[model samples]
Each structure stands twice: as C-alpha cells, then as structure tokens.
Target: MSLLTALGVEKRPSCNVSTTAVLVESQGCRSKDLVNITACSGACSTYTLYSAKMKALEHSCSCCQEVVTSERQIQLTCKDNTEITYTYIHIDTCGCLEVDCSPFAHSETTNTPSRMRSRRRRR
Candidate 1:
C-alpha cells in the first residue's frame, strides 16, 4: 500500500502536474515511514490526510501569485520505540517541485558525555 493509504489519508484527484511532499519518521537508519501527505493546487484549495496517531494536529493552506503554501505539523511514534515530531512547509509554483527531508535522533546525546572524560583527560 502507498504510504498515504497506510496512513489512512484520503486520496484526492491528481493535479495535471502535481508535486508531492512527504515527511517520514523511523527508528535508527531503517527506511523511514510516511507519516503525512499535503497536496495543493495553485488555485485556492489544499488536501491533507492525518494518521490515526495524529488526530489533534493543525494545518493551513494559502495561495498567492500562483503558489500554494501548505504548512503542517505532526507527531509520530515509530515501531523502533522512537518518537519524532516534525513540521513541513510545501510551496508548489508553476508546476515546479521542491522537497525537503530531515531526520532526527530520538536518543539522548552522548557525544560529549562523562564516559569520554578519561579519554579526553589523557589526551
């Protein structure tokens, strides 16, 4: 199943030329899972799908100068026992496309913790 369908998102009529923006969250280096999809036409309407885990999120869409601006925020938990929260903004202009993907670590930072103190002191 398409990630959107897995997320329980209602599919909308495809634009003649449509750009898709997806944000995913997963555990550790594993394939990221699609958590949301936001599609828009340059006109004045946008479509959004929310997963069962994200029922209380908020989204907004606005159109200006043949550009569709869609902003969405969602919080998701992955099967790997990790939680990720993300916000994405998609701008579709003149049938052009732009996509941005960012992944974050869910664990506490140990990059410079005291466990390395002895090594640093010896240096």
Candidate 2:
C-alpha cells in the first residue's frame, strides 16, 4: 500500500459533477435567464513513474467525462428583440473514465466548430 493511503490520508474522487452559471452567447443572442449548468469538472489523476516490470517509464491518466447526458433546448433573446431556440447536451451524470493520452488518438478541432446548433422558428 502507498504511504499516504497507509497513513490514513483521505483521497478525493478523481472526477465528479459540478454546477455553475454559464452565460451562453451565440449569433448576437445571449441566455441570461437560464438556470445553472451541471457538468463534469474535476481533476483526474495523472502520473508517470518507473516500471520494473517493463524496465521503462509508465504513464496513467483519467479524464472527467459525461457518463449520462440529455438533449435540452433553450430560448435566447437576441438584440433585435427576437428569440432563437438552441439545443445542447445537458450532462446529467459524470465520472472519471480512462482515456488515451496520445495526441494522435485525440483530434484537435479548429475553425469549423459547431458546438451548439440553434434554429429560429416562426410562431
């Protein structure tokens, strides 16, 4: 057992859910009357150490992710006094999941980003 663990040191969870108010703005419209957003926002364990089994360095990591999510729609008031509907993923539950730390496995997105899809409708 590790010294810290054997000494009775408390260990926090690697990842968990957190709630915060995030102002969402898009296409000159903003959401100021929205409720707080809940999402996975915790630090994950990452370390590198020497491994005797392989006689080399070893790396381990975990990342906070949304284990459960649901689609949610919100109305944003625009500057023109008009409103638009935006749909987004609401994180219902979150946890730490093992992930590949290789940059090749993870794609870096640039320029063309479509995070939130909004649609205007006629009433």
Highest TM-score against the true fold, candidate:
2
Specify the highest-lDDT model's number: 2
True-structure RMSD for candidate 2: 18.3
Model 2 steric clash pairs: none
Model 2 residue 78 lDDT score: 97
TM-score of model number 2: 0.60
What lDDT tens digits, residue by residue, belong to model 2 across residues 1-123? Answer: 884456453355557778888887889999868556887987766655667899976666678899999988888889999999988888998877767663332455533347456789989
**Against the hidden true structure, what lDDT does model 2 obtain?**
0.74
- Tens digits of per-residue lDDT, candidate 1, 30-58, equal 22555444444444333354546867333
